[model samples]
Target: MTSTLLSAIPRELDVGTRRSAAIAQFISTARQLIGDPSQASREDLEAVARHLETLGRQATLFPEEDFPVDQEHPAVVYRLSEEADGGFALYLSAALPGKSVLPHDHTTWAIISGVQGVERNVFYRRDKTADPARDALTPERTVDVGLGNSVILGPDDVHTIELQGHQTGLHLHFYGRGLDHMPARVVFESRAGGSYRTFGPPAGIRHARITPQDLKAALADGQEIALLDVRDAGVYARSHLLFAVSAPRWRLPLDIDRLVPRRNTRIVVIDGDESQAHDGAHQLIRLGWTNVSVLAGGTEAWAAAGLEVFSGTNVPSKAFGEVIEHEKQTPWITSEELERLVRQGDNIAVVDSRTPEEFAAFSLPFAHSVPGAELVYRIAEIAPDPETLVVVNCAGRTRSIVGAQTLIDAGIPNRVVSLRNGTMDWLLTGRTLAHGRQTPLPEPSAGHLAGARAQADAVAHRAGVRRIDAATLQRWQESARQQQRTLYLFDIRTRAEYEAGHLEGWRWAPGGQLVQATDEYAATRGARIVLADWDGVRALTTGAWLAQLGWDVSVHAPATHGPGAARVTGPEPVRVLVPDSPAPLIAPAQAAALQQSGAAVLIDIDSRAAYEKRHPAGARFVAPGRLSEFIPTLPAQASVVLISADGILAHSVASGLLRSAKPAQPLLALRGGTRGWIAAELPTDSGGDGVVTGDDDQSYSPYLQKDLALRNAGFVEYLEWELGLVAQLEREGHTGIALID
Candidate 1:
């Protein structure tokens, strides 16, 4: 691997004076340290030990001794100095543990070099219900790696490093001039446990000499930038922007979660004083946030820049407000019940109906994005099971609440509920979020036509229809071919037309665009749709697409239409009645109650976490993959099992295990998942470490590459940043290699 090791330590710093004879002295003493690093003398290692000991505070790690003592974990660390490069910059860092982190971005490009040892980087999505960063601004994202050879970092990237192999290490983190202005950090999250956090400009990072008037041109450029007010709430209440989120320098954490959750967006912090905004941005940069430039003069500068301001009074209603109110509130699945469904592999569709931008910003890690406005427009992209439950959400109450009700109002066959209080409530409760946007989805869940599909059973099914090698699917296709049926198979989703692999002879008539282009694919307006998708969303969207095209259609589940859409006009509802069996599916809650009295045994059909997260406290982690082995271990006295998991496959596996041993224990499928239990606020814990061994699950990455990417808009600045990071990683002893890209 190509490495960009720290190549220079100049004799004279850019300050036009020799801050110290350190670099020259280092050149003279380099051989002793590198040749026999284990035998380096105290005097020779003085410079290296100074930073760790003092840390700008005459107390810590080595406070009792002449040098810093070995510390397993500590607080903030000063990473780099401006003298290291010509352009204004510095580096700082902190240690993270306990899996308590949120994926986020930085304020500018930084040189993050590892020290002492290697660390593992894990990215996560912000779970709104658990975005600790809203209060503490945690960083989270889906996993992404640029280079494998270096323990170095670059601009706009956020990650958490756990000292790998040796258990502990250090990092010489670096930040460019622009990053010195952040005031706070923000993270986005969802109830399903996904998150995305962003570091924002602080009140301190603003250029002291620049003025608000200097930013007028950039703002006038139209959507090129944002002016964030970081004054106290009272000050902002007195006067602020129609576009701003009452962002006081002290409130950057709170406001960022509600306003800007993505690092790609450009924002400038403003306050009564420019220093606050500048420092705000500076702090944000140290946290790995980028894309911010503080207001030169705060509010005064905005006025000087000739920008418009508005007096208070546009805040939306909070719960019981006059502007908006909740209608009939629907109950959501509990964590236990959700777990039950997960194990059973029951059809379930969890949707984050926020804006796509918002969804990208943060949402449930396992859930798919179904932008609110796009709900009715994309129902067909969800699951095809008529019994599947669909949950929707927005940032807070309004959209999520409204979206859920809208689905019920439509004829969606599936149960639909809104994430309680949306992401805002999720964060308030201190739950964790996942950052899944980092990787492309193996299966598409939410799409435009998907919403429409939710309204009609046949249409919805067709919309999200996928042709597996199942006998039923093959039989259907064979029947169609023998009958000379012209099955109009439409892939009603956008994105790529089956990036993974699609069935042959499939036509792409994305539901979102089909509303306007149906005529091109309609072919006499009598074509029967054979919608397709990885998750059956295409079928639902197709029905909606047909409705918009004026054709009556059918869909999966029920929530497929609004007040007016399509009408089911073809076949009559077929009601097939079977003879009553000895026993039927049992409720997970009932099972839990029984277990409390030794009346039953709770069985988990998912990963240990899915069950142990909040299932019946005594539930068994009888995973589907380990059914044969687990079956022998179960107690014969337990007669009933509340089978639980994320989907139906596990349920089937559990049922098979029972069959192999003379079908003694009756199994009841959990309707939802662990969500059903947790919704009840039932007791739970971090038990049951799940093991995955299939090809679908990865065990390890042979080569874990830690890398950084800098926007080369200014090559010189980018190189400086790159070099700075090289030094930081080198100091920490990370095996970092660099590539320009």
Candidate 2:
């Protein structure tokens, strides 16, 4: 009866599945034997090693086709299986002949068993007699592991591997914990008092490559995709795909997790060539990003494919504004025409659809600061008489068109028009803009608020935006967590009101900027978005644009005086990931004291322009990316105190510095950064004396450019680019832009 039952089951299980089953059995037996690998004894290690030897003897399970090595990569590592919490991770590695690995210490216990060709493992120990300040290793023993051999290592064990045979080598590697989380793992460059560095997160994945044409097709398709330009901000600002988000390779660790929240979301990294994209793709994979790909030829290929590349940020929003004008045939008044109206003293109200800060910097004549989202809410009050003409303008054209059309869409009883090309056109016509003016929008009357809410709800509903109650929102949040789906909650109110009081976990995103810079706020391409406000008007209006932008957007209005009214105050803090071994933080007073005694040197890693503007009296400016080289040049006994606008960047820079080496000089990060120093009444020097590096770290906006000719030319280029977007969209493909008339 037992033979008949066994014969009934299929005998042709694939080699991969069989190997996985064997690994699971080994892991289960080992867990039963030693529950916590971190505390495993010598006997536990030997027992695991014997189990690995048995796994090694299963020749058919370690199929040659499963692992391949090439010239570009002498060795390739493949993840087999891992615990949900990243414990008991297993991998299969294949290496070609002449491949050698540097001596490294795995931060956790590990075991390796050979399945194919011979591998020479050289063991080493720290030399007790060597100077403690330097790294020194002494040879301990050697082992040649082959088809039936295995090696076991403790947490602190140091070893080097070399493929000695002409044949390709295949082996099984089991670790106490996954390599992804081992930020503290270290590797030595040489055996005798050489420098050492921590092993950074793995950055190699055999990712699929997509051409520029493939990217175009993907964008045209309805599915969400994040096209990330992995170049530096300054370089990316020069030229990039219109829909591409700037996510520099250096900042991926700090930004990617937040930007692309869904692990399975499709993402394509773009660079000048494919080099940075390849590296960025691997890093994304290491961070558990599964559906990542590299643009085969990057941005250069896009340009080569006869596709137009855009300069400046928020290209998608800017382009969409042009489309709105073309499709809606929205009324427009040129700078010349508007000037004539002002001269004639017509009953007109010019409202700037830009932030109050922007209005304060420069604006047209007789314009009031009524930012985009506020346009609908405050328009009735701004133009009391039904016959009054309302004109909206922005720094460029997007906000102008979007703002004016918003009122038009809401059925406001007034002649609505956008200032053609906005303030850039005004400037190009050689007109001086009003500066140092602060015009805030007044609160609308209660009657006007009710009307505004009704209009906004109508517009949002027309745009296909869904509405949800607070209870529904809570349920959706829970469902997102359970499904590992990406969800973003934004308070689409003015920055000041948002900071004064907002939903506890919701992030503050000014309504207009949210539409203009969607990529900046939520990095995930296809995440669910929920916008909230005190009244439903602003959130609904913003939701309209987002829905048209292909977002699964919903609007929520919290009760003003009820159980749902609880809110948190203060700005949200920026989140960053620092290196494993962070530098010690020094308080402002302590740092000042050290500086006063000439025992410490301050390094400001802020932008060169900012460093030149204001910095500690003796602080020297250095880019964070160049800190490693700059550290070795400092005085041997001097404590290096790093500072930024706030202490966050200083801590980040310090962490990176510590990760690479044990500096002879004492390394420190300012506890409160430069802000703390100033609050403590410390002396500061202004101007370029302290700027030791080039001004390349931060990109400059056209408004901030010092060269008038260049600035004016950039404005023209930008306006022209916006005007040409509709034609390009028609020629190339759609970006899920469908306007609701």
Best by TM-score: 2
Q: Model 2: per-residue lDDT, tens digit, 520-629?
A: 87765667899885686888898898888778898877778887789898897555644245679999889989999999999887677777778888898876545666
- Model 2: CA > 4 A from native: 1-37, 41-70, 76-108, 111-231, 248-309, 559-563, 587-601, 618-623, 626-640, 661-666, 688-695, 727-732
List the candidate 1 regions with Cα displacement exceeding 4 Å: 1-217, 220-226, 251-265, 273-275, 304-306, 312-741
Candidate lDDT scores, in order, read: 0.41, 0.78
On the 0 to 100 scale, the lDDT of residue 550 in model 1 is 32
- Error in Å for residue 407 of model 1: 10
User: Which pairs of residues collide in model 2?
Assistant: 259-523, 259-524
